[model samples]
Target chain A: MYEAYWRGMGDRCSLVISGSEVMSYLGGNPGGACWFLEPELEKSIRRIHHLVGNAAAQAEDGGHVVVGTGSTQLLQAALYALCPPDQPEPTSVVCAAPYYSCYKEIAELLQSKLYKWEGDAHNFNKDGPFIEIVTSPNNPDGLIREPVVNRPNGKLIYDLAYYWPHHTPITHKADYDIMLFTFSKCTGHAGSRIGWAIVKDKEVAAKMTKFMEVTTIGVSRESQLRAAKLLGIICDDCQAFSTNTKSQNFFDDSKRLLTERWDKLHEVVKRSETFSLAKFPKDYCLFSDRFYETHPAFAWLISNNKVKDCASLLRGHKILTRSGNRFGADATYVRVSMLGREEEFNLFLERLSTIKIGICNGIAHIN
Target chain B: MYEAYWRGMGDRCSLVISGSEVMSYLGGNPGGACWFLEPELEKSIRRIHHLVGNAAAQAEDGGHVVVGTGSTQLLQAALYALCPPDQPEPTSVVCAAPYYSCYKEIAELLQSKLYKWEGDAHNFNKDGPFIEIVTSPNNPDGLIREPVVNRPNGKLIYDLAYYWPHHTPITHKADYDIMLFTFSKCTGHAGSRIGWAIVKDKEVAAKMTKFMEVTTIGVSRESQLRAAKLLGIICDDCQAFSTNTKSQNFFDDSKRLLTERWDKLHEVVKRSETFSLAKFPKDYCLFSDRFYETHPAFAWLISNNKVKDCASLLRGHKILTRSGNRFGADATYVRVSMLGREEEFNLFLERLSTIKIGICNGIAHIN
Candidate 1:
């Protein structure tokens, strides 16, 4: 689990990655060490300012940009800035169920109540007095929904953390008051800790900037430069990689591998006949039917009677899976990351088959 | 100035520097993303348990470590946590003159009153009812003073931003209620945005942590790893470089170069008779002497009204220097960074000589 978390989020382009480029821009000066000033630092700042404009131009509304230590920091900054302590704190934050789990907790930590709108596969009810946190292609589920209503007076902070490649560009919806995005997700560099917010309203952006200044002062210069560098690199890569025939062929190969694993897991669950499918949204890319079978709570059901939770069964076979409870769901559900090689998935299948035979024959006790 | 800031603060091993390291360690993740969980993030809660132990070890009284985007954010967090909105705010923060300038601005931004205890080179008065901000070997003008007496029940937040290499360690002193330090200075990485506080009281630390959790969540994980990596490298460098005779020789050569510039500047100031020595105790470093001629205020004086008020004259030469007013001192003064190379200093002196010659002949104007 630790390895997965680290590998999934920890692969980042270190600041040293662009040292040569930075040095070239710096006129061979190793760094701005002699004085408390550097021309390259100024140049980097100007570059960021330009990028901000570029990002703003791409947004639905051309709003002011305020940067933060990361999008996570900016999220907290937005809440603190918008939600005044003097007022009765908003009754609760309205978030889609299976949303980014942090939104509810952050709101609760701020003493704000949370209201979950359990949006299943087909529906989203938009009416709510509370601030709405809308994530496109939401985490865990990875399904995109464009809410029909435009809530003007109602505060809305959109988490566009995963909206880059997979989801449609709905930033032009003209309803989002604040939008958040991080470099970690888009560029496969999670560690630089750079994120920015695009607020349609100037007054809102100003408050957030002030809040950020007081909070983290500013994002790290090193991270900002590296972010700018990686952003340029990734944008180029995205354009090139998307068009390459080989890349498309590779995608097909990967999908085939994933489908096979999904089918095998489906067969296993069907054969066991001990569990029934709760709900499987076809629109969701990840979180397939296999996710339901191996959940800890369901595993608990089987474990008490010679059955094992999917995560534990997978884990017993050296496969790591995230406990569903971590995502504000029942422990009976476990999330198996769909990110693995075909061989790895086959290995996971082999382990599940072994566990199933043992449990059915009363050779292995669930407990 | 930006270059100087980096040269003074940037780490050698890691390109990124910031105060995010505190959260990375405490929250067990690099970025403060856990703070945004819809449900409480389990890792954050689990990490906090271990952080409490670490904090206990670091603090005089058992305390908790609340993570912030940076020490600056923590500063604001401390303000939010301590100052009640219900009561009339405290009249002002009584910071030592020539202190870190951010103290007054942060207080004012919070709408608190601000007062200055203008300390001359010889002595600083120790009496005050206001929150006191103390900096040892302070910025621009480095000065360290031993604490005389504790003001019973009064608040003191020490800025130890530069208290790493040049200043003596005083973390052992249990008198301070809160102390702030950043990885930027010690580890030479300001981009990671990691800073920490040692609060003598557990309640104070807890309050601060809550504010941080609400405001910034936690620092970045990628930054933390980079910092941890850089810190190891810095420690290794310190050990390796300190023992190397060649490194000592390099410093000796650099000091000789600096001494020549200082002597030339002293001679020019003596001949001009426009500026006089700023008094200091016998134990003060040679860098203090640069203030007379190289300081922005002094240069400003020479360039304005045939050497009139130091602030205006310095501006005329296209030289950027911080006015003393920013640091709660008389407008006649300005702080200049003495971190330039010998050639840079020589060029500055040449400009000064020309300005002096122009001023004496009434050819220079304050405009």
Candidate 2:
């Protein structure tokens, strides 16, 4: 769908793998600290934690790090860690409405009796062990979330996929008990498939590692090696990424691109009078100490009473969007991705503006 | 444990990853054929299948190929595909008495209601739905195995991890319903952690893919890319990895190394009067169309009645081996890895010779 946009970017985010890497496994070597993970990757992860002042890293109680294929794997590992095999009934996994859609599917797919998907955490009335997944800068809507229901046995999983400085402002050192972060959004290396979790408890981390061992025997050591190198580069460039006019850093380019797309969409929605968007405040970044513009991975757009299924409404105009129902939201809402390259984002804006022009001309096109 | 031995072999298996791969997450690009897999990888897998007439690949009954993180993950996936959630009870999964040790533990770890580890496929008489795991070129004891249970409703899972030409004689095309292979044994890239399954059933392949998607999402695309390139290189070099008369091809090198070590151990056991090795017969290879010597991934060694545990018996003489009890065999037997580099094999030979001298001197150290 974004092929033209990607072509226009033209090596802006292009990658080239060397022949040597193509020729060798270069992972899971006897020299590494463990059979599955590279020691350097672990060190780089530690370095990045300190550099970002991640809450878990800065907490009085230190956290253990476990790398995974991606945050999704880590999420499954977390669920595995939380639920023991001997439980009489499957533990409930609850997420708020407008939650990331994969939560329910991942839980139910295994048909694992250890845990079962029980919908919106707020309505979970059962008195038992349950897991609550909160994605800060949540996908689809891009809202910061907190645990709504407090239970003695409830375990909170903080998915910080979009909490990076480029995607959102670094408000404070985030020190959560179970937090997840991925290299994809932070450095735009989604193809690498590497993510890490910071856990406050030791046993949970060990169980998570055991799950990885019997699954894939752990993450790709080559991927981890590459991740380590790239992470070092990301850390080295972060401070000067958005500053220094001479620097062309990933964070700077990504933030500038997403902010422009978000603003353009906001203008188009306002002009259309047929759609609206939830307001995102310009918050002060604790690290940068400046008011940072809102640049979400996706824009959560709502129909202005004219359309029922806003996703289908957008589809009629040749623009595809994810329906709100996927996120357990009402039919009036839709999510349009803003992470596309300039050409695609601009095309979406153009189509959106044409809708506005049609509305002004008394052409009510909803059928 | 074998650090000194590994160092003695120098750069025989050293791997070097390059700088370009470090900069990018280079797989499943938008231009790639699919989001989860690279097109070249799928092609390479097919190419290797034809190059080595693996039974599942050559059979008149066409099969589908699914790449996995590793063969272990594929094993679990097969179990997941076989046991439906609606089943009244967990299906029983059984392997032979001296099966791969991991089969039982990995099955029981999840404590999945879908399947339970039931020992020995032959003894499983009350089974409603059962999976029979048959490991060809079985680990711990290097021998080709066949399914013992011929029940109508039984599903067979063939683990062909050591069926490659280097490890065993490719006597005929194997057309099993399901066969598993890995790059680790074929190309000596164990660290790559990539494996493929050839399945005769479409529904089974789809279920395996679903398991991957919900687990690690899929195999590491970067690893897949690397495996494809490496396999291509291996295939290209098969006719002439070593051009000179003094040098050897991978098959020649690996077979010669294992055979020499096997003969040395055979000589040592005869002299020691304290242990014995199962006789492995020489076989004819269909691929090479020549009589090939027996060369296995491991040597199954059995201590005399005087010893209670052969693993600990080896450990006493500064050698460590896996206990046969792990593979559901008696403690008197043990598994010695023969796949290590030449230096390690030489060290093992030296230690085995010493056991003979110890017996001759009436120093029966084993209890």
TM-score of the candidate numbered 1? 0.59
Q: For residue A314, give model 2's deviation from the true position in Å.
A: 4.2
Best by DockQ: 2
Question: What C-alpha RMSD separates each model from the true structure?
Answer: 10.6, 4.9
The candidate that achieves the highest TM-score relative to the unseen native structure: 2
Give the CAPRI class of candidate 1.
Answer: incorrect
Model 1 residue B88 distance off true place after TM-score fit, in angstroms: 10
Superposed by TM-score, candidate 2 places the C-alpha of residue A244 at a distance from the truth, in angstroms, of 5.3
Q: Tally clashes: model 2.
A: 3
What tens-digit string does per-residue lDDT give for candidate 2 at A124-238? Answer: 8898888999888888788777887688888999999888766777777788878998866666556567888888887888888777777777777556766787677656666
Residues B290-322, model 2: lDDT tens digits: 786657788888877546677877888878898
- Each model's C-alpha lDDT? 0.47, 0.73
Q: Which runs of model 2 end up more than 4 angstroms from their true locations?
A: A1-35, A58-61, A239-245, A306-320, A351-367, B1-35, B56-61, B239-248, B352-367
